[model samples]
Each structure stands twice: as structure tokens, then as C-alpha cells.
Target chain A: NAGVTQTPKFRILKIGQSMTLQCAQDMNHNYMYWYRQDPGMGLKLIYYSVGAGITDKGEVPNGYNVSRSTTEDFPLRLELAAPSQTSVYFCASRLGQGARNTEAFFGQGTRLTVV
Target chain B: AQSVSQHNHHVILSEAASLELGCNYSYGGTVNLFWYVQYPGQHLQLLLKYFSGDPLVKGIKGFEAEFIKSKFSFNLRKPSVQWSDTAEYFCAQGAGSYQLTFGKGTKLSVIP
Candidate 1:
């Protein structure tokens, strides 16, 4: 099974443009997350969903929105792309909640460049 | 603000050398610590994690980390390094449910 699948591995958007980063997981995980990775900055959580139709903001939720329409899908939307939004986006999913989450399975990542 | 801090931004080492990467978190309550590694052109993967139980936690690939609450530290260690160990390591805390706060990653380059 494709653990976590992220679409448009690479994308370029102009300032003020909008786009969505698609994420789907076949693992049937109830927990899905969107994170952005920047050089030397590590990965910052952008948004997360514990289950379908339930989403929450994370530490770096600014400039992004997420909708969990289904348990297998949680897409991150960039409403108005800016140069500062350029970063590698990753989608991850884990099976459980609480501290017992075995581990999060990550996608290959989508490299987005906003000019 | 809650933060996870990695002391070193980068580290270089020769094969067979020992390794230790320091990490600290700002939150004081129950903490879930994790170390994730990203190899060249790859997605991040879990190296190990500590939610509770023993202070010392062993992970995949002969890697381990010790959680010292007194110091707010969860340092990753490896007895010997290999060229294949070259990767970027991130120290993160699973804060407030499943939300993760990560420190600036430490790039580790192991020379053969």
C-alpha cells in the first residue's frame, strides 16, 4: 500500500496565486498532518486532523488551511502564495492518538517554490 | 512559546566515531520526545521516540537517545558512525496531543 501519497511533487506559483497540496494515505490512519520543511528550520506543523471533518491549527498554521473531508485525504491549501511560502511540504499519518502513536509515515514531499 | 532546540546546526564525523546530538524542549508537562532522520533526497523517518518508561530509548539502526527531565534534554547517541549515516536529524517534541514542535535540524555528514 502506498502509505502516504502527496501529489505534484514539484510546483511553482507566483505571488498571490493559490494552490492545493494533495495528500492521501492508504494506511487508514485516523491522524493526518501537514508540515513544511525549510532549510535548517526543521519541519513545522502547519495543520492536523484527528479524523475526518475535524481539523486543528498547529504551531505554524498561518498562510495555510486544511480540510479533512475523508479519513484518507487531508489537503493543505495555500490561499495566497508568497515567496516566504516556498518550502518542502510533507504529509504524514499515524494510526493512533495519545502517546501510543507508533510512528508517523511520511510522504515523499512536495517542493513548492513561490516567486 | 513552546520550542524544541537542537544545540548543533551541523556535525561532521569520520567513520567509526561516536556521535551525540543534544536536544531540549521548553514545555515542562508530560512530554513526548522524538528523533527523526532524513537521508539525502528522502522523506523523514522515525529514528526513535520516548513517551514514557525508561529514560534511555533505543531506536532503529543502532541509534539511541536518553531523556533527562532534569535538563529538559533528549540527546541522540550512536556508538559508531558509518558513511551511510549521513543525513539531517531533527529533534521534535510531540506536544499537546499529536502536534509536533521541531528544532532546527542538525545535518550530520559521516565521512568514510
Candidate 2:
């Protein structure tokens, strides 16, 4: 089962360019999240969705947007990419709340570079 | 705002040495703690988690953590280490909120 899948394992974008990072989960989970990992800085949340048609901004939401139109897909949009936006992005899904058994499953991650 | 803290940025140990990585969180309410490991070229995976019950929770790869409520600490430990144990470790906390606050992470390097 492809628990969580993130498309375009690697990508490069020029400054001021825009692109979308696609994420999908097959587990039918209610919660999905987008996070970026920078050197020495663990993971910073970008956006999240509690369920279909519901989304919310996370800790680090600047320069990004997200939409949850279906239960399986939650995509993050980068508007006018900047050098600071160059980081490894990860998508995760959880079955429910912060219960012990509801630990999140993460995708392989997409390494994005903005020049 | 709640936040997680991992004190060790980098740790190096020879094989079979005892290991301990400190983690602390700044949330007082009902909290759920977790430890995640990321091997080289791989996605983050759950190493262990604690919701309730015993403070000393054991997880995969002979790793375990102890939750000290008074100190707001959940420290990961292993009796012995192997070269394969080298990886980056993260500590995260989920409180009354839906999202988790992750620490900066600790990189463990176990040399043979």
C-alpha cells in the first residue's frame, strides 16, 4: 500500500516561479500535513488539512498555500519561489488525533531547489 | 505556543556504547510524545511514542524512552548501540492541538 505518496522526488525552480507539491494518501486518513525540513531545523509545518474541503495554515505558512478538495489529495502551492523556499518537503498523514496508535506516516520527501 | 526541544545536535559513540538523547517539551496540558528516526536517504519513521501509562516506553531496534512529567522530558535511550543505529532523531509533542511541535532534532552517529 502506498501509505503516503509525494510526486516529483526532486525539482528545481527559478526565482519568481511557481509550482505545486502533490501529496496523496491511500489510508483514508482524516489528517494530512505539509512540512519543510532545513538543515539543523527539524521539520516546520507549512499547511494541514483535517479532512476533505477543510484546510488550515500551520506554523510556517508564508509563501505557500494549500487545498484539500478530496480525501486523498492535499497539495501545497508555492507562489513565486525564493531561495529561502529551497528545502526538503515532506507530507504526512495520520488516522486520527494524537493517540499512540495514530502516529503519522510520512512520504519519502521532495527535495526542492530554488535558484 | 508549545514547542519541543532536543538538546543534542550531534552525538558520536562507538559500537556497544550506551546511548541517551535528551528531549523536552514546553506544554503542560495533556500531551502525547513521540520519537521519530530518519535513516540516510529514507523517510521519517516512528521510533516510539507515548500517550499514557508507563513512563518507560520501549520501541523498535531496542530503543526506549522515559517520560518525566515533572521535568517535561522524554529522553530516548538504548543499552547498546550499533553502527546501523546512526540516524537523525526527532522529538515531537502533541498537546490539545491537532498539530505536533517538533524539536530541532539530534543526529546520532554510531561508529564501528
Candidate 3:
């Protein structure tokens, strides 16, 4: 089972160019999240979805948008990319039982570069 | 405002040496703690987790973490080091909310 898969292992975009990072999970997890990892920095949450049709902002949600139209897919959109947005992005998901202790499974990560 | 802090930015150790990485969180309520490891060119994977029960939780790869609630610290340690253990370690906290807050991470380089 592909726990979580992210597309475009690498990407480069202009300052104003827009792109979407695709993430999908086959585990039917009710919880999904997007995070950016910077050099010497821990992963920072950008956005997350509790379930289909439910999305919310995370610690660092600026310059980004997300939608969860289905239980299996959560895509992140960068409308106007900036150099500050360049970093490795990771997609994660977990089964949401009453106890929210489920381990989050992460994707291979998308290395984005803004020129 | 919740935050996680990792004391060490980078650590180098020789094989068979003892290991310890410090992690602390600033959350006043109940929280779930976790340790995630990322080897070179590999995706992040769970090393261990602490929900409730024993304060000392054992994880894979001979790693273990102790949760000191009073101090709001969850420190990772291993009895022996191996060259294959070279990786980045992140300490995260799960609050009442489902989202997790991760620390800057400690890069562990185990020299052979």
C-alpha cells in the first residue's frame, strides 16, 4: 500500500509561477498534513485536513492553499511562488481514531526551488 | 502558541558510544510525544512514540526516549551507536489538536 505519495520529486518555479503539489494516500486516513522542511529547521506545518471537505491552517500557512475534496487526496497549491517558498515539502497522513496517537506516514518529499 | 525545541543542531559520535539528544516542548496540556528519524535520502519514519504508560519508551534501532512531563522534555537515547545510525532526528508534540509541532531537529552523524 502506498501510504502516502507526492508527485514531482523535484520542481523549479519562477517568482510568480504557480504550481500544485499532489498528495494521495490509500490508507483511508482521516488526517492529512503538509509541512515544509528547511535546512537546520524542523518540519513546519503548513496546512492540514481532518477529513474530506475539512481543511485548516497550520503553523505556517502563508503563501499557500490546500483543498481536500476526497478522503484520499490532498493537494497544495502555491499561487505565486517566491524564493522564500523554496524548501522540501512533505505530505503526511494518519488514521484518526478517538486517540490521536497514530503515527504519521510521510512522503518522499518534493524539493522545490524558486528562481 | 506551541513550540518544540531541539537542543543540539548536530552531533558526532563513534560506533559503540552512548547517544543522547535533548528535546523540549512548550505545551501546558496533555500531549503525545514522538521521535522521527530520517536517514540520508530517505523519508521520515517513526522511531518511537509516547502516549501514556511507562515514561520510558523503547523504539526501533536500539533507540529509546524518556518523557519527563514535569520538565516537558522527551529526550532520545541509545546504548550503542552504529555508522548506519547516521541520520536526522526530530522530536514532535501532538496537542489537543491533531496537527503536530516539530523541533528544528538534531543531525546525528555516527562515525565508523
In model 2 chain B, which range of ten residues has the least summed lDDT? B92-101
Clashes per candidate, residues 3 or more apart or on different chains: 0, 0, 1
Model 2, A1-115: lDDT tens per residue? 9899999899999999999999999998988999999999999999988889999999999999999999999999999999999999999998864343468899999999999
True contacts kept of 2: 0.62
Write the residue-wise lDDT of candidate 3 on A19-64 in tens digits: 9999999998999999999999789899999999999999899999
Give the candidate number with the greatest DockQ. Answer: 3
In TM-score terms, candidate 1 sits at 0.93
Q: Comparing 1 and 3 by TM-score, which wins? A: 3
> DockQ: which is higher, 2 or 3?
3
- Candidate with more favorable, higher TM-score: 1 or 2: 2
Each prediction's DockQ against the real complex: 0.62, 0.64, 0.78
Please identify which of the two predictions, 1 or 2, would achieve the higher DockQ against the true structure.
Answer: 2
Better of 1 and 2 by lDDT: 2
Give per-residue CA lDDT, model 1, range B67-88, as digits (tens): 9999999999999999999999
lDDT of each: 0.91, 0.93, 0.94
- Per-residue accuracy of model 1 over A1-115 as CA lDDT, tens digit each: 7899999899999999999999999988888989999998888888999999999998789899999989999999999999999999999998757434357889999999999
Cα lDDT for residue A57, candidate 2: 90
> Given candidate 1, what's the lDDT at residue A83?
95
Residue ranges of candidate 3 with Cα displaced over 4 Å = none
The alpha-carbon RMSD over the true interface for every model, in angstroms, is 1.6, 2.0, 1.1
Model 2's chain B yields a TM-score of 0.98
